[model samples]
Target: MTIHFSCTQCGKCCHNLRLPLSLDEAADWIRRGGDIELFCEAIPWPVEPPQSDAQAAHKRRLSFAAMCGAVPIRVIVTVVAAFDGACPHLLHDGRCGAYGQRPRVCRIYPAEVNPFIHLTPASKACPPDAWTTDKPVFFANGQTLDSETSELISQSRAVAAQDAQLKERLCAYLDVHHMALANEGFAIHKRAPDVMLAALERLKHDRKQVAHGAAATWRFVSNRLSTVDTLVSIGADTAEVSSLPNALVSYIAFFPSDV
Candidate 1:
């Protein structure tokens, strides 16, 4: 089925959202007095994903290579401005206060960052009227009708890859190193505006050191002990979140899958 979408200016999309941001946008987020959270997840990468496959290519493009104990892995990082209620810039009239200066993600609204993911209107925050026939066809024949959105998505993927290593090191610098398994969930690391800004700033200038000095170690955190045990059996270092009373890390389990 074809998908038609147009912003009815219902402003639902702007409310109670966690917008992903680039590293630069993350810095700007703090300047706006808003908080940013880092979400990190990793997938085992014993062998390089095939460049010919769309999902593999896309995943490799957005992740950085690193070792998990003795296991090699590719880690993906997401920096988000996690705000509740209405967006800080959402005007009373439903206009974006800083529309012109909105983040690239805002410009790519209602679309997914993952190529394999399909857009489901019912799953979106947009209202039913926003998907009426009168709206422009957003997706058809497995393609997005909007070329600019496609371009922005590509750019976002490239930039995420560019910042992948730095973002990982940023976590290391802040002592936020536990990661959830990819496709399962994310290890949420919320940082205060000042702390995150300081870490980013300090890490920015120490890029060379962070990238080349020493390989900072990382551990896996899981809600399922069986999952962690599975990783441990495979020689991957693991951290039990239950044992850490004061660790900044928290796990968001997507499914309680049996290991």
Candidate 2:
């Protein structure tokens, strides 16, 4: 069945949501002078039941925490930032501050795209009156997306999948284990942008180095490094560890583990 939607510019969708971002997008946001931590969050990979013995073995081999059911079956990190009650980019007049530069997910809004669903109206989040079955159907842009919606949805799905794959590759390269999401209501520090930026750069450099086998000996050495040392090398301030909130500390502590 065909769906119809038109954004009222009420700004409801911009509030109280987790905005997931790709690595490049996060970097771009930082470059744009945006407060990365205030609007972004890092989510660890989710735990899922093993689909096969092989998959279960892979998970177990990745970390002892997984074997003990403390870690997720997959080992990738996702970046998401909280919007609290309203997006910081939402202007006072109900307009987006970064309208032109908004993420692809925002551009495709009211239309859902994920691993299980694609090109469907997000009925629950959308206002009732925003959708209609009569007359011509319109999208957020006030244009008919009937023919283009499918392609847009496909592209969005592809991008999301690509981001996940990249994260997985990075995790494999770095031999990461036991990554975990922070508690939903955890407080983020003002210095989150600095910490995340440093982490991102370290991941990028380490991934490249590992790819070329820069130091076969170093890989073995890195495996022996403690979580604190790993965090410090990745630009996390060990000195500030004592001052960080409990949630952040717990999340960081899950980074290093052995199967």
Candidate 3:
């Protein structure tokens, strides 16, 4: 069934709402000279420590939690401006200040035309006669909608794929490191141990799997090694540890000596 919708310019959708944005939407908002900062905040995800006692629990937490949780497929990381009470951009005259060039999200208010999902908020904020909800509807203000829609779908898919790949790599790294530490104890105040060598080898292999080029590999390997270097500099390995490596050594240093 063909359906249409018209926005009543009520500020209900703009106030106390967390609107997710796509890459295109974010770009459009930036072009409109919108205060992007007001739209988004970095929300930290909850994390549980890795199962392995030897694993760097905090280090693996971010990547591990991300992998286990669902990544929003089309929701690109962008500033989502919402007013503390009502949107600051909303004017006392019952209109948006940047109506002509508002964010793509704003332009499509109350009508989610994207095929993957639909969003509908109640009509309480609008005047009693200004809007209707008798039926589910989606409205886009454009001609040649098919072509534009196709292009947008394609671009959103590409972006989703890239984010998936990055999340996969990070998860794999955490998974491998966690496995290496299982059932193994590492000394914090000792030189590299044999087990440490094994852990390093596993970590290096994981890096090589993700990093293709020599330069890329070098950068990745060096960054991983730098953590060890920092630990060693801080006297994490004052004595020789035959089975524990620098990572394990560093992990131990953070615990109380009684432990």
Candidate 4:
């Protein structure tokens, strides 16, 4: 089976969403003088609510204590564009300003990178006209779809593995249990820039120390997660809506599934 694709560069894909970044890509963006807080957000792993009525009732009972207590907790770190609007790196002409240094997700666009799934035109983001049941189906870069998809799946796995390792260390450092789920949801647009800036610093410091003293450096990562926990706790306790951190607002809103 062969599928063809060509990015028209219409920029339809660049607007109205966050672009995910790997840890390395994010650090490089920060180092390039990008305002990490203004442009980036850390999205925690998402949790799915119970589907059955009885399970929902049980969940409600568990949530009677506090709203934040009901949040499905996880240790994954995924950075994304901070705004609900277009990406800041996107140029007015529908081209990426940081094209050379774009994130892996962007690089693998319109391709299904999940190893468990087979790539088909129906499963990709490309327009109907972008594909054909023809010979010599070429990706945007001229590589055959088979070749590109294989490479992308391999790359995605490596990146996912790195993220998982980081999540493990972060969870251990914070004394939190790890739960795996397909992370989803948009990061809050407005947040305390200082909070994220401090976290970025600690992340960089910890990454450097990982080669020599991983366990010792994990304390810094633990402190960052502790801050997020404290903020969420405060937001859950307060009735004053304005007092909640933007991230907490999004996190709590995701529960019960219907909202």
TM-score (C-alpha) between model 2 and the true structure: 0.55
lDDT string, candidate 3, 142-192, tens digits: 321334444554554454344332333432332221111111222112122
Model 2 scores a C-alpha lDDT of 0.48
lDDT of 1 at 248: 67
Candidate 2 on 1-259: residue-level lDDT in tens?
5566666677788888667666666666665565543221222234544667664543333222212132123322445555578777889998999898877667767666553343445544667666776524644343336566557667765655555544544333333322322322222323456666665666556544423421111111111235335444654322222333344322233234331
Candidate 1 lDDT, tens digit per residue, 1-259? 6999888878888988879999888887787777888888999888876677888777777777788999988878889888789999899999998788788888888887677888888888888888999889998887678899989988887778888768767877787767898877888887668999998888778877636533558788777778789889988988766644354667778987443
Cα lDDT, all candidates:
0.81, 0.48, 0.35, 0.45
Candidate 1 stretches with Cα past 4 Å from truth are: 203-210, 245-247, 256-259
TM accuracy, model 1: 0.89
Q: For every model shown, what is its TM-score relative to the native structure?
A: 0.89, 0.55, 0.35, 0.54
Q: How do the residues 26-124 of candidate 4 rate in per-residue lDDT, one tens digit apiece?
A: 556666544332211122213445556664433332121111233433333445554456777889998999898877777777665544345566655
Better of 2 and 4 by TM-score: 2
**lDDT at position 55, candidate 2:** 42
User: Which candidate model has the greater lDDT, 1 or 2?
Assistant: 1
- For each of the candidates, the C-alpha root-mean-square deviation to the true structure, in angstroms, is 2.4, 10.2, 16.9, 10.4
- Give the TM-score (vs. native) of candidate 3: 0.35
| lDDT measured at residue 31 in model 4 versus the true structure, 0 to 100 | 62
